[model samples]
Target: MIKILICFSVIFSSGIGLNLYATHHQPVNESNALDLAANSKSAILIERDTGEVLFNKNAQEVLPPASMTKIMTLLLVMEELENGKLQLSEKVRISEKAASMGGSQIFLEPGEEMTVNDLLKGVAVASGNDASVALAERIAGSEEAFVEMMNQRAKQLHLKNTLFQNPTGLPAENHYSTAEDMALLAKELLKYDEITKYTSIYEDYLRKGQENEFWLVNTNKLVKFYEGVDGLKTGFTNEAKYCLTATAEKDGMRVIAVVMGADSTKNRNSDVSAMLDYAYSKYTTKSLFDKNQQVTSFNWLKADQQKVNVITNDSISILHKKAEDLTGIETDVKIDQDISLPIKKGTAIGKLEVKKDGKVISETDLVIEEDMDKAGTFQLMGRILRSFLNK
Candidate 1:
């Protein structure tokens, strides 16, 4: 994660007078926002790109996550795929324990073989407990070891209100998480594009040719009915109640909404829908700068490269209330740091501060655009003599 330092200052710029340095940490005032009076026990809405919380209620209240815990399962699978430790075409032999899962499952029989791809589909679209456990065993050698990996990942992600007892989210003491924690997990899950391919499917057949073909219907109904709602998970257990972590993207903005411990499925859907609606209606995001764009150029005091261009490797997006005025926003570049000889191409030289109406909204590190070599010995001596003569 990139650490952003946000500080406010009043600055003057050409064409824009009295520019504002807007800090991204400033919370949006909720006075004029819609009254979410959501019925779910805990809920939150956040911008996917910026991780800004738009609305939340009791989001840290830990409760049974049910199958929503599978988001981490999917995340770990995606990571393994990216790292080449796992392949989609590889076959997994179902374990007797995995075949015995009781809750939502693909009904795998012991010793039956399935590809990692289909198992992913079963878990993502069908919420298959058997598939989840099978993949868990395949990834970490055993379900218990996989749970350890899951908890380790959660700790690395800084999730404070979470604990996992099983890969299928089966009801067990101490198996719980908060809405906020689940939303964060969903945010991480969305980073892998491969996930959406499976999660967005409304219905598909698992065993296409066999006589006992299993049809998989998405547990998340909103994927079929709600526009832009492609993914996430739904959970329900006698002890957990109804839970959902719904994510949607419209235009260029994406938002994640999580609802936990709702009294009914209707209430969960309604609350998650309301949160999405609030996010779309009240907030907006803009791509302020594209990745690798040269933001500015500066003189290199002692390097072989006479000049260095400050560049950004990641795109910068600003999120704000839809009603706020954006015309007066401006950016301020700060470069008080020293430049040394032999600077690397991606070395951080300074920072670009984005301001809205004179307050710092966001900031990104400015890096050296290209590699710089040290000045030759003769050139360094000549420059030293020239500097002394000039002085």
Candidate 2:
């Protein structure tokens, strides 16, 4: 009888005890590799959703960005639209300076009028230099002032290797950017889906009834040739060579590719396509948690609820190899021990860390699932008294 009792006790304790045993472990295969530009000066391919760089070559080396600078100009315009300072239907009159501008142009005659929508299409689809200048002037009163705003916005975006001499990306003495910086700018631009509506159009007519009416064809040929390819811009000059910022989406994954100073447009298009194909083929996104999913429980102080549910702010997904087994993924949730009297719903209180083989690979914010109002003084005193009496 004594031996049997001892054996039962050991079994019960072992079953109840928490053990730090490894749940899953697997090796990642790296057989898949990305194809790159042959005669390209610099190139980079990034996962759009997660901002992960899958391939990079000379990405940090600063060089002339040519019309790729227009990406930033469009970004600032979008910012204004988002802030309610400008509207798409609002008409802007072309200034004398804008009308007189040389190079790729919308042929805006002085005092000619066009909607913001048309100007955006002119710049995005046709890479119209005059339209860029006209928009810049209308937005900031002068091209020089708009250029200052562009530089300031670049600094705020932390584009370390980017400098802008003009909004139209006309070859200036000092206009320059790096593959990495252009990638960063492209990533930001992708956030504005409205921009793609213009960039992706293969052909369109601008200024239908005006004397400046002109037919426009998208300069970025990838939008027409490559599947799932949308935005963004293409640039070329004797000095800047051929530059393109292209984005493509496949199987719920979006990828951004930047190529600067390609020897030819054909090479630029091919490089971008190869890099995008490599990204979609090798990696897939895995969602770990859904929005509002309960990640953990935390104690609340002086509140009606004893415990609060910790929820995820947004659904989180990470890029992983297609063949790699997911049995190795481990999730750990960490929360504050005692949240103070007042806690608001959606307030970030902790973090959920996802790991593979004890190495943290991804993380998401943990938020309060529900609101907890502060207790009144009387309620607080009553709770204190109750606690003392129980003790």
Candidate 3:
């Protein structure tokens, strides 16, 4: 590792800005927003692209997540798939502990084998506790270890209001999360849009042409009843009552709404629907850059190809009240820390901040477009000779 100091390398250009928003580290304040939740104890709505708050009511209050804990479980599973640690086509064997998961399960038997794709369906659509534990075991070798990974991931995301004691979100002491945390978790999960293909399913079958063919139905009713509502998860237990974290995209703007501690499924779905209605009717977003859009390029003396493109990990957008005008836009690019050769494909190189009137309104991490390897001795020598000749 060479000593290198790179910070605020340039001020790039993007578009759209008016009001400002702090990053997730600071709570979003959508003042003057409507009270969309009539029955839920705590609820929140945020634009997915910018993570700007659209509505809020006791969003930080911690409570039982119930099956919504599967959001974190799904996130880790998605991450493992992305990292090539797990494959959708690969099969995971069910352990006795996994098959023992009782509440809201797909009825996996001990020693049964299921593909990762089907297990994902089981968790996302059926809220199968058995599937969750099976995947947890496959990823971390055990459910207990997977729970630790959940806590570590929560801390990495800067979720101050979440603490996980189990992967199934089963009733346990010290197992709690907030509307804000679950919404953020859903946002993270949405980064892999492929998940919606499963969560959006209203009904499906687990076993094909078998005597014990089991039917699977999505616990989230809004996926079918509500237009543009694709997913998320629903939760229910004696202690937690009813809960939901829903995501919907309409006319280019995607939003996440979370309703927890509702009295009934009707109230839970209504709270989420009301929040989504408020968001789409009141808010819009301006796309600044597509995913993987190049922000800038710089040379690294140590790499085989010195010139590397810096791009965003996700699409960049600016959230706006539908009635407001867009103006006062400024973009700043900052190299977060030391930069050297041998960078990974998705490693954060810095951050891009969209500002309005000197305050940051939107922020996203900048990443290396692809992996880079250090130059060999011959390549370095040839570069030195070329520099000497040019001079």
Candidate 4:
């Protein structure tokens, strides 16, 4: 028989052993104009560095996504690649169903063979519908099953306003996503930097050996037209009109803009570009607090130490206007009056709430930074005597 032993340690900050506990809260403000006079039915601009919404217009309304559906498909495929379930060098034979896919294709022939790397390039840079379908078939044995996986992933990501009817975001009656949902999906996709290696390519060649070399150009023009513009996806259809999900990184600031139902391709591109500019120009990242920094000191009762230092668990940063003075900001460290013994390390014992001119700006968790061993009987008695004597 094996006995399981559970040993808990109480952590303190700056060599002090005391218990602390509290709640943390913060208030955020969003004030940016990226949706200026755009006829787009829905739009959103978000700061990629922090999941903050900079501007939004009818963002939650689910509308036809068109080719934008490929974003989620690419995300799942990248996840599979990272998990070792799929490899870029692996070859997938095109099936009849994949070859039959119409609208924006790399012209894959049935029984034609291509490496997963080329297919991913086709889908990411060229927005090739045929490549998307072929990859889907290879992953799930059928397009329908792959679509189901997309829906399941959507639920897992909490994209409530999204539904996928196809692996490639072609025009489908039931397939739709809101501007807000698309932004969320884009944020999640950015976690995997591997996708950018292909999305940022402006032009490339495919099928070099087969007598008919194919030239591929990225559908998202910003990759070549704008500076610091990397990726996302572009979409268009009679019903969905012109849509674009553009991502840009500059001066350490990253932003994602989603526009849907634009009247023309030019307006869609302009709207997304303007949104990115507004976010990068108007806001900047500021480090408010750091982890394991001493926030305050607390008095202990019947303990070996009379006082303990409180600290934070993680560093916190906030996006604010450049004109704002962060040094003048006031921080209030709140903790429980009393904490029990046998406390564990890394416990959230309190919070450090920073405010600017009475308005709370950011809050971070104050945790125990070091472990505190349990006091023995004699130690406890000595602490009690000390407490009484100090009184």
Candidate 5:
């Protein structure tokens, strides 16, 4: 076993692919081995579907996220929108405190009303401090309360290194996140398609046709310049420096890349672009099976139903490098010898493990696809008699 510790500043500028583990404890096939390094303080590139880290550099180093903190803010808004607690068409009355927020705003005035849709646009496109505070206050009744919610949600998401001091990514002591944490947040935000509707817009008008209509443009320029790039956030502050958490999809593969604490905008964009380019150029995503795809069937012990179908609870996909032959990869499905009665539809019977060159690459739970009820004593005896007679 070889441990390769990569320093990005030296090797990344040359565009060399580092044969780093796309994930820890799993080895890519020799043919698929590639090295990736990025010139940034902290960076990570992950496949969205599988959450595989194609490349990482100081990914766990906690740092101020600046406006990228709004990813969590957006996540909370998305949660409210998804649970039907908030509506896009519903109007939110701006508070004096919200309007008083500093840096990157749509210039919302106190007592002015804006729909949730427009407010989301302001946060996603303009990186609006005022808009973020308004939505935060609307959801949690106060920015401080909303920040509490953010921390709670972070805990739920198992993000240990993330903390939120404010909703709008303002520089504050003790408010910081790791690239890994921010990338995870970006992944959660992508679950809501409505977010992309605003993040993808290169330019649009807020309060259209009004006397004080504000022209909103996306702070993340990669939306226009990079192919397959759509929605994400960018950040910069004296403390946070230039940072971006970007996501893009191409040919069924979605990637999330985070670059934080860059020296300049050019450096930040370049580093993110390089990480994304490396991911797209080197990998291909392949789904092994769809959810409910039958793996095998087995007779149930002590069940009225004679057989239970085993299947995958969710689809499984793998990111293999272009040069590698997926056929070379091995899959072994390990299942229980006898499935017992009273089985639930999603009960895990065992697991399917994927290996490349003897190293475990991925694993998915194998589950019973349908419920199995226990059989009465008489019924079990009758079935046994029938089976014996047939044999």
Candidate 6:
């Protein structure tokens, strides 16, 4: 979820390239054992917090993402939940269109009703095309509208090569994304954290105690077979071949890896596994701030509130090669100086940059803790006048 935005109306930089002393760092090797170049059409591995690229092969090549398209679907669903526009307990009626979806489904009957929670389970654990359409219809009033939302979001994230023809990664004429873009989507989706509760489940019964109960299993098998590997998504198509976006957390550092257009499932898994191995072996992270931790504050006579707290939008970290020396590290915080009021929550108020040897190694946005509206004209004058008199 790198180096990507999870909030509405947010923009992200492509992230730092760690040229810190310009040592000619390269994460890819065709002759090396990583095998990402040989096993997959496109692939990328990145640190979740720092958005640092560890290794990449054909990362920007646009290819069908298959079922991994649901990563954006899940991201939008989580945003609705976080914004209180949707609730997990809410119920949705299955539409005929939703029920008629082909390829990898939970088999929802027409007119059947399911909770948003269960539909998420179906989509996350089963790659349910029907469930994806169900949630899409509920959120945006139609699958077409939801697909529009998905494309708009992709643009907002500054993803250049991604476009959505549908919510499920079912084969479609114009539906495609790059490995780097898919990794960013997974990074954005992972900010919800609660998503793993569904994505990590290897097996579960969807309609328990019912005669037509459906058994749902995760398409991403690494969650069950690999230690610390929790989620993401897997896909296969006659055209797209096999794909997987996988994440694992070990020793407090989480990493995401994406593989697209592999010839077979075993190769797909092998490629991602090798990518993960490369990340864990070569790099480690230094934590700076936990998510939502206060970094600074500001007060102004023109604001409705007397003061506003600035905090990190997400946890901040610095990535380093495991054997690299730790020295010459410094952090710089710069808050916006130009005065403006009525800023909404999640608005970037400032920047935090970490430099090593006077070069920026990492950067993250610092945001306001809550909304701030303008102060009354008279109130602002009074504060300014009082300050002048006191001085």
- Which model, 1 or 3, shows the larger TM-score? 3
Best by lDDT: 3
Candidate 3 residue-wise lDDT at 272 = 90
Model 1 misses residue 334 by how many Å?
11
lDDT of 5: 0.80
Number of the top TM-score candidate: 3
Summarize candidate 2's per-residue lDDT along 1-391 as a digit string, tens digits. 0010000000111110111111111112221243467668888877664456677777888899999999999999998887688889999998888988887887888998888998999899988888999899888989999999999999987998888999988889888999888887987787777788989999989866756568889999989998999999999999989999998877777778899899998888888888878878877665556667876664444566656677886555556557654445556676655456466777877767655556555556778777877667787788788889999
Superposition TM-score, candidate 5 onto the true structure: 0.74
List clashing residue pairs in candidate 3. Answer: none
lDDT value, candidate 4, whole model: 0.76
Candidates arranged by TM-score, highest first: 3, 6, 1, 5, 2, 4
Which 10-residue window in model 4 sums to the lowest lDDT?
Answer: 16-25
Off by over 4 Å in 4: 1-37, 286-317, 327-391
Kindly list the per-residue Cα lDDT of model 1 for residues 1-391, writing each as its tens digit.
1222333333333222221222332224562254663678877777765566777677789899999989999999998997789999999999999999998999999999999999999999989999999999999999999999999999987899999998889899999999889988997788776688899999999889998799999989899888999999999999889999999989788889888888888778888887788778876777766767987775544667666677874456667666665554567767644455566777776777776555665667777778888778787788889889999
Clashing pairs in model 5?
Answer: 17-35, 18-34, 18-35, 18-36, 19-35
**Model 3 weakest 10-residue run by lDDT:** 3-12
lDDT of 3 at 363: 83
Candidate 3 TM-score, true structure as reference: 0.94
Residue range 1-391, candidate 4, lDDT tens digits: 1121222222222110111111211112333333352768888877663456777777889899999999988998898897689999999999998999899989999999999999999999989999999999888889999999999999987899999999888877789999988987997788777788999999999987668689999999999998989998999989999988989888666778899999998888888888777777776765545546676665444344546666766554455555554444456676644466656666776666655444554456677655555556787788778779999
